[model samples]
Structures are given as structure tokens and as C-alpha cells.
Target: MSFEKENIPSGVGGNMADVKKSGYLKKLKTMRKKFFVLRGESSTGPARLEYYDNEKKFRTGSLTKRTIYLRSCFNINRKSDGKNKCALALYTRDDCFAMVADDEETLSEWLQALLEQQQAGLDGAPVPAFGKCLSSQLSTYGKLWWKPKGLGSSKNLSGNYRLCLTSTTINLVKMNCENEDWEFSVSQITSNVGMCCMCNTCI
Candidate 1:
């Protein structure tokens, strides 16, 4: 309910005040906004939610405005108690953005829609074609720049690798490899940060 400086970046821990407090609403002066939420089509490709600046721009069919990729979203929440119960917040890796609903009932509907969309992102997106792993469902896949510890400025030992994820093991394969020399396994890992591992280490 309290107004924040718009477009300000929040931490990874998320802006807790957006979820818990609305005490300073009366003292803060905020700008008026006219926004339209737009949804992307369902697909394995990158899922997204866009908000147009205004109604006329949206009706004119301009689809390239402010966009939030669901894959990067880490949290979603709606106000549990407040003078205005229509505030909903979306927290991504770097920002916390909020939207207001017409009423509490309308807020519930919007929350449900957002929950489903956010959940869909958790299932995975933009699956790559790994010729031999058809039986296993992909969680996420992307190229990673891997530089091993204890190696000081070693260009030969550090290079780009494709990290693939499935139901079980994380497969790290070199972009150009002829044998198993470049393929890495769990056994090779010595240690990792606990929180960085996430809820499930596997896909």
C-alpha cells in the first residue's frame, strides 16, 4: 500500500516491506499510472508477462514494451492485511514490482492467474534438443562459463561449457569435445554454497 520509488532495484532477499507494510501511504506522494497487463502464449519458449504504459498503446498492438521474464521470478505475494487489500507484488531476481486490483475479489483472480503463470516457469522453458535424452524431461539448459578453483589464470583449463539439467544428474559438456575428458560429473565437485544449491539440486 505504501508507495516506493518506481523502478528501483531490490535485493535478492526481496523487498519485505512490499509484502508486510503499508504504514507510510499517507505521507508519500506517488505518480498516477495507467497500465495494461499482457500475457504471452503458452509454449516451451521463454514465458513472459508484459505491462503496457497505457490503453491506447496496447490497442494499437505494440507488443514490445516493459517485459518481465517469468523464468527469473523468485517470488509472488498478495497483501494479507491492509487498509487496501488490492495490492499484489511480484518479486524477480533484481526488482519488486506491484499492481493494484479493482477489489479484493479481483485481486484473488489476478493472483490465481499469476500463480499459474509463475508455476509454469518453474516447470522449465526453452528446452534444448539433446539427441540422446528424449526419455528424460528437461528442467533448464544454458551455456555456463566454468572456471575451476586452484587454477590461476589458466585459459586452457577454463572455458565455456553447456550445462544441461534433467530429473537426476547435471550434465556439463564442453561445446567442442570428442571424448569424455571434458564431461564433468557430481564426483568431481568438492564443495558448493548451501543456499546456492536451491531447494532441489537436481532438475
Candidate 2:
């Protein structure tokens, strides 16, 4: 329940070779589940909704298109109005959902509670968050980095970088260059300032 590192399925590695070979990648292609955690003022809940893919599940009629839903029922039990403090964390087939937390303790506590509830469930719970995150991250970044012939490739781009702008700056970013080639470079001072916006810590 703690999601030890060793418990993750084998084959995924630092390199992309395993991803192409493993069945996990294929499983993701057909995945239809939407899992998300809702962190609220005084309570938090984790929910999973699975929408049946018409192409994959081909039973006829309106009942065939129905979505299956499952959720763990629990409350965060926070004291005050903590919407500003509340954060949602989840994992999907594409990426790990991590809401920025004030500290590590909050993250660990939520994870522990979630795991305990999962273990107590009648049916086996979903995959561990860490494993799900890793698989999702790899699949996402792999797609971004993969280059197919003919198409201009994103392989040259680094996906980890951040881009942001304030309301006024956003307006400037949206302005037409009018055939002028514009360029901006970050200095050490600008880089430090950029970090605050990138992490959403200042906001």
C-alpha cells in the first residue's frame, strides 16, 4: 500500500527501449478511466470514472455505452476553509497529477490515508499512484520525443521547461509581431524570477 519502488512492474527503465517492448504501453492506448482527487475546504475525495469506448466494447444498445463509476469514500477533515491550501493529486494514462502542496507532510499523510483505504476495499484497488505516475510520464514524454519521418519533430524540444506570463505580459505575448522576428533570452536574474512563476509557489 505504501507503493514501494520494487513493486512496480519490470521492463520500464531510464531508456525508451522498454516502453516499446512492454505491454503496459499498449494497455495505455485503450485506457478509458478518468481518476482524479478532489481536495476541498474540509474534505477530500478520490473518484474514478470509466467511460466505455464504443470501438473497444462493441455490445449494442444504449446500455452498452454506459460508463462504469467507482470511488473510495473518505473525507480530508480539514478544519477551516482550506480551498487555497487544498490540492488535488491523481494519475492518468498520460501524466501524474500533482497539485502543489505547502509541504511534504501533507503529501505523505494524504498518500498514507489513501493507501489504507485502498487496502481495506472489497475489491482490489487501482494501481499505486507512483507506478501510475511513472508509466504515464514515460508514455507522455516518449510520445513528445518520438520523431516520425515527414512530420517536423518535437524530439529537439525539452518538455520539462516552463512558459508563463502575467495578465499584462500575456497581452504582450498575444500581440502580433507584424513580420518582426522577436526573441527573448533569460539572464540569471530573469531565470530566478522565472522559477517563482514556473512552480506556481508565488501565486
Candidate 3:
């Protein structure tokens, strides 16, 4: 359930697969505490954050699949929508962390910085990606029966697909294994042919 690490090399027969955190494993990989310093626009001086643990500890290195698509799922909420705008909330899968900035302007700056970083992450995807990871946040995803244009009615195109849509891209992932996927960019779309983009579902 954690990041994949290098397995210990055995002489010949390695029974380490069944062993969970054995003494021999501890000698090779020792747990450690890492320190992080946060520099924000607030005048409250630099903040020091530390993560110390054994099982679910954070590590520094290349971005994983979860981190790459983090913005697509994670949400940043402003605590107060009316008056007090200095507080911001970061949401995880099961936890919400709130922090107060020095002032409203600082809070705005922090929010802008986080949004920029999320967008920049899309542009910085590593080559030979684990798979086809999206560079932008996915706004909508759903499965539907797609109909291709032809002489007959909409009943002929029986291709089932899952549509993935972002701000700039539209992708169709095939259902089962019969049809191939099709992807299109916003710029590639042409409206000169009226009623070109039509949708119909299979009964």
C-alpha cells in the first residue's frame, strides 16, 4: 500500500516475501525523520514541518501516480466565504487541515501559488509515464454508449465508452476490449460543419 522499494537481494532462495518487517529487513532499510521548512508570504516567520513515522511516512523523490493526479481529486476550500478570509482549508481523503494566514492578501497569494503549482505539475510529467496520466484536472468522467455517424439510425453504433473530459481535452476510453480509444483536443474541433458534435445513447 506504500511506495515500491527495492527488495533485499538474497543468495539463492529468498523467503522474504512472507516475512513482514523482519529484523534482517530493518538492518537494510532504517526508518528516518525528514524535516521541511515552509516559506509563505505571511510575516509569522518561517514554519517548520516534520514527518516522523514508520509505516506511512513521506519520502522525497519522483512524483508517483497519486501525486501526479492529486489536483484532479484534492480540493482546497476557503474557510469563510463571507467576512473572515484569512483561513484556508486543505482536504485529503479523510482529513481536513486548516491554516490561518497573516492577512487576507496573504491568503489570496497562497491560494494563487497552490493553483499555479497544480497546473505546473501537468506540464512536468516524466517521460515513459507509468501510463497515460492527464496533465490537467479531470472535470467529468462517465460511461455512455456512443453512436458513430452513418447512413442508418443511432442504433448501429453500439460502442460503449467512458468519456474523460478536462478543460482542454476530450477522451473516449473503450469498454470491454472491442473498440479503440479516441482523443481530441479543444483546438482540433471545428464548428464549420454544423451539428458535427452529436451524442446519442444506445437503448
Candidate 4:
């Protein structure tokens, strides 16, 4: 017996939306400029190293201005990081890309172009772009204990602290009349595989 049905539910297929077509749409808007010695860092490979298209068949990735945040390489402290000096950085929340040009002049030109696009996007000018809003989302919270150094083992058993996880940082407060408050970066958290942050003798 053939039980498979071709038709779907009313609410399921009606709400479907079209995917982003920014990729090919952007290429058509910008005109090809005749420039000499235009070099850019490869998206994949060593950090800030000189990149060349060793293979004849190579395609460079393009960025949409609204999705990325741009910063001049000079603004970033790259001394200990081993990043190239003559470079421009473009990043989103999840990914980062650094491009290096031949000279300072070339790098400046690239930076200027990126900034111009960014400003245009901010001004509400139409450009092929994609981005997300993070401000409206709510943060999750959980009960956790914070034990001070030199505190006795008996104090750890009380479980008096409540930790609130925010978008950027962790807000911890002692659940008592004092209402002691503490805030720290989410990156400072260290945890085990099976175990959570709540328990006796938590750091």
C-alpha cells in the first residue's frame, strides 16, 4: 500500500521564505576598476602571510558591508599575535578575515573603500548585504555557587550564589541580605565535559 502523501500541512509550506541572493547580486553593482598590483590575503592559509594564487583556478571571497565590522590593522595590537602590519581586518561575530596588501598606500586604499561601504550601509543606502540583530534576545540564567578562597568546606555546602548569564558577561550575586554582586567575562569560565558550573567548592 502506498501511504506517502505529496501535500503538506497548511502552516508548514505557507511560511517558507526565499534564501539570500547577495552573492551574485553584489558583483553586478560594482564596476571593475583598473588598478596595478592589487594583492589580498587568502581567506584560507597561514596567518597574515603573503598569499598567491599558485593554481590558475582560484576564486577570492567577497564580503557584504552590513554583515562585517572593519578596522584598520594599525588599530589592532598585533605585536604578540604575529599578524602582518600592512593589513586590514574585517570580522563578524563568528568569523574574522585579515587581508594584506603590498604597501601602506595599497592597504590604505583598501581600508578607505571598506569604510565608504560601511558608511553607505549605515546611511540606509541600498547594498547587497545580510546581518542579524542580537540585542532583543534574552539571556539564560542558572543557580551556581561561588566559594571564596580560604573559606571552610562547610561554607561550600550552603549553595547561596545565583549566576545570571548575559550576552557578553556573567553576573553572579550572593543570595543573602547583603546582595553581594560580581561580574566577569564569559570567556573566563572553565568547565568539565559531564559536570556543570554548579556544585560544592566552585571557583
Strongest candidate by lDDT: 1
Q: Report the alpha-carbon TM-score of model 3 versus the true structure.
A: 0.30
Model 4 over residues 129-170: C-alpha lDDT tens digits?
112111113344335554433231423423455444556665
What local lDDT does model 1 show for residue 182? Answer: 33
Per-residue CA lDDT of model 3 for 32-151, tens digit only, reads 222211222123211111112221222322211112122331344455435344665443322334455556676676555554444444454432111132333344454566556531
- What lDDT is reached at residue 114 by model 4? 50
* CA error at residue 78 for candidate 3, angstroms: 17
List candidate 3 segments past 4 Å from native: 1-135, 150-158, 190-197, 201-203
Off by over 4 Å in 4: 1-83, 125-203
Of candidate 2, the 10-residue stretch with the lowest lDDT total is 18-27
RMSD of each: 13.9, 18.1, 14.8, 17.7
Tell me the deviation in Å of residue 114 in model 4: 0.5
Candidate 3: C-alpha lDDT: 0.36
Question: Which residue pairs show collisions in model 4?
Answer: none
**Number of clashes recorded per candidate:** 0, 1, 0, 0
Residue-level lDDT tens digits of model 2 in 7-47: 11111222222111111001122323322221211111222
Ranking by lDDT: 1, 3, 4, 2
Instruction: Compare candidates 3 and 4 on lDDT and give the better one.
Output: 3
Which candidate has the highest TM-score of all?
Answer: 1
Which stretches in model 2 have alpha-carbon errors above 4 Å? 1-88, 118-122, 125-143, 149-203
Q: Could you tell which candidate, 2 or 3, scores higher by TM-score?
A: 3
Per-prediction TM-score: 0.42, 0.23, 0.30, 0.28
